[model samples]
Target chain A: MPYPEELVSPMRAELTRLGVKELRTAAEVDGFANGQKGTALLVINSVCGCAAGGARPGVAMALEHGTKPDAVVTVFAGQDLDAVAKARALFAEYPPSSPSLALFKDGKVVHFVPRHQIEGRAPAMIANDLKAAFDKHCAKAS
Target chain B: MGTFHHDTHELHGITCVVETRGPRTWVGRVHEVGPAGVLLHDADVFDEVPGGPTKAEFLARTAAVGPWPRHKSVVVPAAEVTSVRRLGDLSA
Candidate 1:
């Protein structure tokens, strides 16, 4: 059954407030994933304990690093069904996982963080993992 | 496993979304679409989106979405999409 709007809205807001764009439909996912517009950070958000306790906070802190993606966007799994399906299309080679993080540059999957990585880890540790990806993929700001 | 690593440009050819059906059918959005494993965002509501049901009630009433395995991200085709919306800069 569809998740009520109430439970997912705050999670959406939390990501939105952090400047994370919400891809609510398939076209939007294509628009963001199709073109080579620098690096984009795609966060697969969830409502699990690990997400609240680790993933979300880790994402916020990781963005604080000097090197980062040009854009950061997100989608909720159970709620935005079509949108999530569309976004996953961009990762043609990889399998699907929730509460994951994928960094794309020039429209390619450069780095990925699977669910296992987020389940038990602390926010700080997650941030460190993301920061390391940023260092390797993100372009240095001039 | 080992620490995640790769070039950002390497993601160009992959799909960023995947469609999978199980006990509860729904789509997954790829937060980070890459070769390693895609990050999926499953939509849900809990005292947020207007007209949505309450969290407590939602949990009590609805079945969980899935039991997706670890270390895997699905690839969705672009043709299945219906629309796209930008949350920020509503004017955009």
Candidate 2:
């Protein structure tokens, strides 16, 4: 079952406000994965406290960096089962973990940062980590 | 994994097939792909022989850094990479 609509409302907004396209269904994830050209960032958005306090904010901060991903998208972990399943399917080489971050180039999971990396980190530190990952995997628009 | 096939570039969670100096192909997650070189994590070494069989042995390994834990990742130089691909996709 999905989380109550009112519950994750703010959680959804946290990323949407940053212009991160929410992949709310299987087809949406399929489309995003197939349609991507060059590099894309996938955040396994969650409703955990760490997510609210750090992950979302960190992603927002990372986007503010001069360099940005060609496309940024996310899937709600508990709310959108199909979407999350499909997203995680793409990242099959790694074990399942929530509130994870991944980078894909031409649709391949090039980089991954698991929950172990995010659990206790601050938003700014997460942002810094993402920015560094972005600097490596993501290309700044010309 | 037959019928579950996919080109690594089209699939997610892929390994690098970097070719540097000799004919060695490396497998690992890609860190960065830039003009200078590609950085890889959790890298492993392999050898591909033309018209011959392919063999992958743990001939090489590296410690991961930063957000990437050393146990599951490594840093690899992708400058001279001849090609990159995923071994295959997971279940549908």
Candidate 3:
């Protein structure tokens, strides 16, 4: 069963408010994953307690940095079933992990923060990790 | 301007084609091309024509044929991107 939409609505908006796009369908996930040109941040949003604690807040803080992903998007794991599945398929190369963060550049995997990384970490630490990747890969394209 | 640079920050909210190294070729309005990855809206993925055997000549062939879309608005990464090109202008 999926988490109630009412329960997750505010969580969804949390990321969207920071400009993260919510991918609500399988097609949406496929469209984003298939041929992306530059960097993208794909978050597998979940309803776990840790998600609220670390992933969500961490991502929001990470995006505040001067250098960040060109686009931010998310697919709720339990609620957006097909969308979440499709998103996972894109990560077929990597192990499946929800409440995860995958950053891509030019359609290739660059930085990944899996569930394990978030399960027992601080939002600030997570934010720092994402910021580090931004500094390295988000350089202006020549 | 002749000195125009495709600054990473400048790519926010515009449509373009992102050609990369692997099997994915993305097309959509660029949401952002930040240090981590590019975010896009109404994005679609076409097969990335590969190096020797499995590559499909997509844009070249598609341009000759007609406007066809493979996928739409989703998010991925940019670690393998090789090039970015302007396909059209975003509506103002």
Candidate 4:
């Protein structure tokens, strides 16, 4: 069962507050995952400890980097089941993992961070890892 | 006992301890096992760091208490998995 909306609202806000678009439906996921432009970051948001402790905070810090993806988006796991499933299908080569981040370029996955990478790492370390990926795969933020 | 592939369906629904090639270990009920990898539900993942509890010590502790329940679902890729054991068999 999904957690109550009230319970996860703040969790949702963490990214949305940073201008990350929240794709709450499968159709929305399709719209973003397909026909993407230069670069995009797709975050499989979760209510797990690693997500709270690392993923969200890490992404927030990474975006502060000068070079970053053209767009950033998220689909909450469990709460937005179909949306998360649709997004996961985009990264079929990888196992399904929440709090995962996929960097897409021209509609292809260029880089990915699975749950294992975020599980024990500090937010700053996660941010640095993401910053490196952004530097390699993304353009300088305008 | 009927003979079957130990790495396949035999582990489904069983709570198992999964160790990966990296720092991550997972304790969860097996959901699926295929060429892709093992899928676990209600998984508790422990990522061992330098100077932290060794995998054995962590497993023993988990066996004594319980899995940490960190992830709702997770998949350990076939290439990354090192071993899988029944958590129940561990001597806490």
Highest DockQ model number: 4
TM-score of chain B, per candidate? 0.23, 0.45, 0.58, 0.82
The 10-residue segment with the lowest total lDDT in model 3 chain A: A112-121
lDDT of 2 by residue, A1-142 (tens): 7668788878888888888999999999999988678889999988765577667888888899988788899998888999999998997767555677998888887777665456546889888888887788777767
Of 2 and 4, which scores higher on TM-score? 4
Please list all clashing residue pairs in model 2, or write none if there are none. Answer: B8-B86, B42-B73, B42-B74, B64-B70
True contacts kept of 1: 0.02
Reference-based lDDT, residue B81, model 3: 74
After superposition, candidate 4 runs with Cα above 4 Å error: B1-92
Model 2 per-residue lDDT at A52: 71
TM-score, chain B, model 1, is 0.23
Candidate 4 retains true contacts at a fraction of 0.00
lDDT of 3 by residue, A1-142 (tens): 9766788888888788888999999998888877798789899887765578888999989988888888889999888899988887876665455578988898887887766456546889889989999888886434
lDDT of model 4, residue B41: 88
Writing each residue's lDDT as its tens digit, candidate 1 over A18-106 gives: 89999999888877776658899999887665567778889999988888999999988777889988888877465566677889989
Alpha-carbon shift of residue A124 in model 4 (angstroms): 0.5
| CA RMSD of all predictions | 18.3, 14.6, 18.2, 13.4
Q: Candidate 3 A-chain TM?
A: 0.94
Scored against the native two-chain complex, candidate 1 gets a DockQ of 0.03
Candidate 4 per-residue lDDT, tens place, A1-142, comes to 9988887889899999999999999999998977788999999888776688888999999999999999999999889999998898887766676777999999999988766566557889889989999999998766
**Model number with the top TM-score:** 4
Per-model TM against the reference: 0.61, 0.61, 0.59, 0.65
lDDT of candidate 2 over B1-92, digit per residue (tens): 00122442332233334556767656555556656665666555555667654543322222121122232554344556666553221100
